[model samples]
Target: MAFVGMDPERIRKVAEQLRQSSHQLTMVNETVQRLINQATQAWEGQDTLDFSDAWTGQHKLTLQQCSEQLEQMSTDAIEQIAQQEKTSGITPGGPGSALKPGDVIPGTTIPMDGLTPDKLNAMSPEDREKTLEAMTPAQRAAYLASLTPEQAAGLLNGMSPEQSAGVLAMMTPAARVAALSAMPTEDRRKALEEMPEAMRDEVYGAMDREVLAQTIGHDVTLAKTESTLSVEAEAVGFKIEAMGQGEMVVNADGSSTVKLHGEFGGGRTFGSDEKGASVTAGLEAEREYQFASPEDAEKFIADLKHAATSVSIDNPNPIDDVWKVLDSGHHVDRFGGYLQAEGHAELGEFGEIAGGGRIDVLATPSEDKLEASLKLHYDASANAGDFAKFSSGGEVEVKGELEHGQLSKIELKASTNGAFGAELEGKSSSGALLTTTHEVVQGSNIGQGGEVKMTLSADNPGFSQVKEALQNGDVGKATELAYKYSDVSYRQTVNTVLADDEHSVKLGAFGVDVAKAGYHFESKAEVSTLIMEKPAGSTHYYDISGGSR
Candidate 1:
């Protein structure tokens, strides 16, 4: 079974994406505030309020107050998100690239989600042995803690799963117990579940069964934490009740199998893994939460494929290569000059875009151009009523070529559902720009009207620095650079929304409309991720409006 679950890497990816969305929204909000302030100022300076000066000032004050509230709220929300990121152990600015396996510091929260067998195996053969000899679990944990989290993550990611486990197994039993005990319940259990049976048994025996039973689920179809015992905590949830008694079966592999059978109503078997174990229900209400089964090692490859964000992420190497590269504990954005990427989408017309986020691309060199497939998510749903959500709503796919970083040729096709919903044949080709200005002259009402000729550094950031940081997995670097290097041209649409206008409609303080046109522009810059050189199309918008009365 493959683990297409919320692993750490995936979590970081999703969070980073959301953060970007938040920032984009903030920019839109600021634009609106600017427009409101401008409109009030224009009325006071250019148009006659028709009402008393106090009336005009009141309206201006109201607008100003409203702007402040919104600005404060936005600021607070952004800060809160930052705090959450820190709490979640998300490395600032990048995919948790800084987190290392060795970061399992003694006193800090231990992170074991990234540890996999492949990572251990990839380490220098002697490295695991060296670590085992060099440090006890507490010592190792402490040593890792001494280094940066990234360094720890790096050390762990570089080793093979066995190597990593071996290191952990070497922890002085007391240190192991302390570290495991200190871990949050879910993480401790999950980490133990991922370890080799011997190592797992060591820690598992010490875990609080109540906590383990509470947090762990019974569905092992996805093989989340390899050993099926993780499911024991949820046998009932899986609809399997304990039989008269559990049986211990001796396997030819010298592994011990704890056979637990209860009534589960399904008819067919859940199928076997690369290992011969199978879970049967209905015709046989019995399932094996077997420990004697041969440990599955290549399972992670299946996981990588299952966890694939886009079809393009598949590399041009042996299946093992995926784990090997991931095991290297280094950024692997591009493999052999090819990169795989994904984005979010919207599901159910007017429904929450909760699960609709989907866009995938694989960029590869084609002669002097790039070859890629751009897939866009159109709809999605869960098992609410009749059918599963995604089964019905597929995607719009564009197979295209780009010349000199610009889209050149393309072929597009949409799923029948997508085509039907959009009223198109579900096929199309597309190619897809941004400016700003400020001026104050004559129409000035007072010599005090300050010319805020403040130049906004309009220089378009090449995005090279941020993009480079992104590729290197230095999210913190990437984010810092993104701010240091920004794209201002995109917001010019805000001008299309509204700008410094003279003599616009004014709402008199007396609630009477003064003669004049009110100026306001609802400008919006679409925020979206580009895949296959085609923008998924951003529904995010920003607008500004203001006019003097």
Candidate 2:
């Protein structure tokens, strides 16, 4: 008769052989890797490169795949033997006792639906796992999805680490993050410790940036002990307020000289006092975050890519928040800081411009405060096509604060002045110039009685007008047509709190008004708390009104 099932003993023997072969493959791979590592130190030339590439890009991968295949085969064989035993009733007095090396069992099948939480809980740990392993991924996922949170918590609490991992492996990434997030803090940490490194990284990547920030407070080991000092200064002896791009220098020897430059895009400038000359080179700027390890850096980058921010500020989230998200439920023994500066300058047709920016980031673990600041400045003058001369100068300053990895405050100051002049067809001559300044301060709290405010004003001809001006070579005409489209806004907020001995109350008032083109918007808010002395508690009240044009 044809064999319907292999002998369990024979299957076990074959599995042992597969396992041995896999072990041998691993040994060979290790030896080969050692040889490659040694050769890498002394190797040179195309032949060496070719050998290394073949070994790493093809041969090494092939060997690893083979080894994994062997191991999987061995595991499958053992599992198959167990399943057959269970199906055939292999005990001495059971139905399959009389069967030989080649035998067949009639109508043997395990019902997937027979596995329930009750059955799972009643079975021995080994049998429970075996039943779980028998289920397909779809079956496992469906079964898991059907369980209530309480049920899931109970089930997971009862499972061994391996079983728990297997259950989690069946979940989608989002579901997995949710599951972990729902777990009790200590249990979650223990579970993470029990998980495989690859699985841990996957969990980290899937977590919310803000949530991850709190979790990451544990694992990191270093913090910044000090900050670097930075200084910058600039001076102008004679500057034409409206020229936007011209600068005249009166030397100490009673001689004066004027320099004009114009350029487009981004660049940097270098000068030599001895040579009395300078050069401007076009370049692009780059930003980077420094981390203690490559793995941490990778996680930080991944979280940043997936993170979302509210429309409250122009600068990025504080560095501490980024660090916390990257940390992901790890203790940070100490904090560290990162400082970077980059500058560039380019010479345009009419004027010379140089600009650069700086970033300072520090995390104070002791005070639970994080600070970050940035500064940028630029000046340039260039011919706008054939008909216009364009010149502009601007500077930006921003400071951000985070308390315990949460944004608590921010401030921004910026100013710009520029002029656009055009002589269309060398006959229709027109020119326009504008200057702007903006300041904003936003915070969760401005101390006990602190105030917050912002002032903004701008006279932009709008982009469409600017484009038409550039195309028609009549900037002055464009301003005349669209300069009426202007914007001005002001906001002030005051917060005051009163507290003594046994009772406390707070009062707040905020107002803002904005006007642009012919439209206007205004809003106001006021709040007060009822005063209560010693025995009674204080009560607060508030009212707000939105203004209409």
Q: TM-scores of all models?
A: 0.16, 0.30
Candidate 2: tens digits of C-alpha lDDT, residues 37-116 = 88888878998899988999999999989987986787677556555656665532234433322222222244444445
Model 2 quality (TM-score):
0.30
Off by over 4 Å in 2: 1-31, 46-50, 53-62, 82-155, 158-192, 195-342, 349-549
Who wins the TM-score comparison? 2
Worst 10 residues of 2 by lDDT: 532-541
C-alpha lDDT of all candidate models, in order: 0.34, 0.43
lDDT of 2: 0.43
Off by over 4 Å in 1: 1-164, 170-174, 177-194, 197-361, 364-549
